[model samples]
Target: MPVTQAPITPTYADSPPGPPVLELTGISKRFNGIHALNDVGLTIRAGEVMALIGENGAGKSTMVKTLTGIYQPDAGSILLDGKPVVLKSPQEAMQAGITAVHQETVMFDELSVAENIYVGRQPTRAGGRIDWRRIEQEAEALFARLEVALPVRARVKDLSVAQRHFVEIARALSQEARVVIMDEPTAALSQREIRELYRIIAQLKAAGTAVIFISHKFDEIFEVADRYTVLRDGRFVADGALSAITEAELVALMVGRAVNDAYPKAQAEIGGPLLEVDKLCHSTEFDQVSFTLRRGEILGFYGLVGAGRSEVMQAIFGMTPGVTGNVRLEGKPVAISTPSQAIAHGIAYVPEDRQHHGAHLTMPIQQNISLPILSKIGFFLRGHRAHETQIARHFAEQLELKASHLTQHVSELSGGNQQKVVLGKWLATDPKVIILDEPTKGIDIGSKAAVHRFISELVTRGLSVILVSSELPEVLGLADRVVVMQHGHVRRVFERGEATPEIVVAAASGIELESARQEENAA
Candidate 1:
């Protein structure tokens, strides 16, 4: 089993418990004769953060939808302040004081921040005309309350990911939400942004709001939640105060077994440099970036959001325009101007945004898996079905991808499974080098471990990898060498033995190495 850390005492552990603002009793949901949730029960009291933990496909999404009135439970009772109530729709749920800030931060990109915050319930004047002035003022006041600064008049599309999330929270609070559910809120946030979110949650709790914090991150659960509830195989496995349980216990509850290690970074024979970038520069994104990846090695790129790590990766993958760089593969210069050219040059990139860029949601698993190699399988489409199925099944089984069948649509699968399909699709290209950006960003610990093991296996088989991740532990655990970047500049490079959490964090955050060393010495 992975070494267990000391149990952390939650911040609100000793607070006097209040009556539950929302309670779910004997909840059961089914779809097409498949039980997604079975007799599950949960209670969220005011002024507390209750962590909802589960593995992917453990019915956490179903429960969230049911609670938010997107899915009506076949059998259950929802109690609002101990009174039975039925939430027939999302509007009804909002009217009943329930609101959610989803992981994707659903909002209209073209709408201004103030407009998005008050879209459905825009402030009105005497004649029912939109009071745009009131909207902006109220939004500004709301952001001020959260201690966050955001331009209310700016369009949502121009805002950063973290800024958009602040708008989502502001919108939730504007709805007078007494029960605020945050579903995987930190999946895409940087460490600093996550800290700010925690601060905001604390503020919400102090204001008597009940928050349901759902995430696969154990550290977040222990740090912020007063209580935790675990679901396994669509059934409630455990529920208790956060201070009373340990991380090891929580993992066992979620997966029904021990995970020996989250990162199984295998040692592989390091060969000659497989891919090299000399003075790679992207206009307005990143500049003067340089790195080298070797055969059977995992090269990690670490940076905070806006640090231009992803931008650099995209440029290398031929997705960014105006990229000026010299790329060498096996000591030979290669010009990759498009994704097809990159693929032909034996390079594949599994993008971070899997939903929008990685997979074809409407296509079948087999089709998505075979998409990269369709041209090779006869363009006339004669006798291609069996060939496609064989290819899909091969990579699917190789990656331990779980799906109803190869014909199943990618959209029907869970987040973890969809990620697997993305990985499978790329592996089908038989590329010498692969770039995985935030490979396990939103998946559960079990799935993250699986992906890590798979990546290690790929390196062992002589495939070079460039892993871009925001999670420090992941970078430290899997990378043979780490490239730290800050503000579009290469900050530092550390070998495996030399890199530590402190060192990487300092480099990524622009802390001078000598100053960090001096601080360490003073300590």
Candidate 2:
């Protein structure tokens, strides 16, 4: 597929210009005395893809919320088709031809694909009865237009993550939205799925739809976005065409400084096997899965979403039942039937869904960190204030978590800081084997580096780690060895010396190993 062309200039021409599809002028918003957006201005043209680039807590989400009417700006003027308009709610925004697809897929798992596509706005017949047939037919048509295939009657829960993303795009298109905002739409998608999404974006552009693409991935922006806008500390910093700047320049603009290395890989020594899984089988999610994790070694599980990577971890962590396997710690087979059991065995798992699994939104950082290791300090029946303080202090300094005190609520912290608190909680447990799933998702570069360093340090201290990540570069940088999975089975394993981006990708895609390597080298 042909890549989309970048915009010719940063700002539109002063006097000679076409009418903007949407515009936000001098937009400002504040939450509890914190400025979320400061005089931010943006103008999106029809048939163009504008990338909203920023670090976590950089006001990208806030701006998107304002645009979609999720949050009304304290001061601003919105113009649609060169005319000022007031958008009071999300419904109003959609009626005005604006639609948003959030990072978290919002769909009824039990509902059929057709039902999900036309959820809130179902078709009606002459007698005002719901038109199921029409809904299914329309959904099929929408998917066809987007080049996505899905059974209209299939349950959403049965579809893969990438397929669900396609459904989201189809739903948006069905709404006849002229302006679409996709926030990290590719986060859960594989390379092939992302390429497909890019094709859909191209189709949208051809249909004169103004797309707002929000992502932290630099390569995707360069490949698909026409123009770029940077926000920092809730303020607009720069706006320009994608071709007018380089990746380094864009990073500098987004973070307000140069990032010498996005992936700062530190070297560590590998030791004998600390954790080993033999003949692990859990129903259909995994089968005969066997791997050995050495002390001070990072083992990466690289695969597409729904490739059984998370499922295997879930089973090993005892989050799921019906597993027949031999999990050994220091050459001793142990039974792990629950999370607590895994914890007792000196195993820690950082789940992929941080908001749902890692932190309690309403609880303070200290409480979240102290929850796991509460038994370690004694006073199980009584509160251990001193112990809590010591744990918080140790991690607050080590993780560079930004908070006035440990009493600060986890929800009050930024994405990066919340992630730090989660890591701090696990680190406090002193686990010999740590399973991290998507550790760097939605976090900034600085925080990612800090997390990477912590992982390296843990391994150096004789901790075995199972690293599951969607980012290929991260897997390549950190893993001493990589195991690729597809369709609920192990396809290939590559040692550190043999593992490259190409080899890993090929393995995951089910191509011949040697042929895949050659193809990668040729590229």
Candidate 3:
């Protein structure tokens, strides 16, 4: 939302929220006879942030698409200010004062910031020429109003990830958007950036814009949203004020059951060392990184961002060149310089960026799942259709993947399902050692439980796993041993009993072990 010239006093802070600005009743959408959203209902009042709560595959993405006019609901009624309106296309939705900022920032990299803001509908001079100057002025005004200083003339590609998101918000403001949808906006943002976003949301609230905030982070929802709406299996379960319910109740409403443990560690017998890395070195990212993965063990590499945790894993998986490392599998030295070689040596890597690096979005689910093992079968799935389908279905079922059919494109699935598809593809290879980086980054709590269970099952089946994550609890709960990395080096390796949250976090931040213990003891 654009910053206003006047003082930003949130009108909704003390006063009660006003009437509904947007409402959806009896919304239902289907795909190949499968219900994506069934009889879903929602309401968003003016000057309020409504937290759209749901587990992955619980129709959050479908509702977002339906609301954005990317896909028209087969059965539903949308009301704008108490009057029913039809959103036939995205253009119509935008014209009707609704704009969406997706989790994945989609912008024209070649265009300037101002140009991107006014891309489709640019103001014109007398003869319909693009008013570049006016666009820049308006863009600057938007940033000024938001109190964010972004270079309006700079190319979009040159900006930071946070800046690009601000530009997206500025674009929505430029449209005079009355109702804005933010889907996991903080997924890629730093904590400071997230606080800035909260400030922006407050300003938008002050200006009376109804914001639909979609997120799987319960803390974030409770922090920013004024109200709550729950959807389970594509149906409305409840809606009310945030202060009226607890987080556990909200989770239960969204998932249809009580979650006993956020991280359900798998039980497996640990054997001798399965893989060992000695002095793993990258030119810039990391140095002298050494770790060991035992048989049937989940070895976790935990660190803050830019700690070279992912780079070390990538180098081990042979995706990074100029990586000098001595890798031994089951006490036998193995030389690998490419991903195929790594896979041939029983190594698999599930990357962090699932959309770009892990899964092929345009490919069918069956094809994507069978991609890693195509040589074991055949190409194009011509004569090996049954085998491919059988293998795909096996892992999809194990992963609890949701889809219309195995032939459906991965692009059409929700974010959590896409992550599952990527996992299914790599697991199809049946590798002895798998490196999973940020495996549950964008997935919901329920789906996360499913994934945690699956990872536990992997170790029980004798597959050694290396888990890298920025989430502290996940690493602490699931990993048999935690290897803390800071800046490019291993700070400490803690046994399961020794890896306390406070101590591990301090080590990861480059504090001395003794000091960490002292602080822990003091606390």
Model 3: per-residue Cα lDDT at residue 484: 90
TM-score of 3: 0.62
On lDDT, the leading prediction is: 1
lDDT of each: 0.85, 0.82, 0.84
After TM-score superposition, what is the CA distance of residue 265 in candidate 3 from its true location, in Å? 13
Per-prediction TM-score to the true structure, in the order listed: 0.59, 0.59, 0.62
Q: Give the TM-score of candidate 2.
A: 0.59
- How well does model 2 score by local distance difference test? 0.82
Rank the models by TM-score, top first.
3, 2, 1
**Of 1 and 2, which scores higher on lDDT?**
1
RMSD of each: 7.8, 8.4, 9.4
Q: On residues 256-337, what C-alpha lDDT tens digit does candidate 3 reach at each position?
A: 4322367787789999998999999988889998888999999998876557898998888888999887999999999999
lDDT of 3 at 420: 93
User: RMSD of model 1, in Å?
Assistant: 7.8
Question: Model 3 Cα displacement at 344 (Å)?
Answer: 4.1
Please, what are the lDDT tens digits per residue for candidate 1 over residues 442-510? 776677778988988899887999999876667778899999888799988888876756556557655
What does the lDDT read for residue 83 in candidate 2?
Answer: 90
| Pairs that clash in candidate 3 | 3-145
Clashing pairs in 1: none
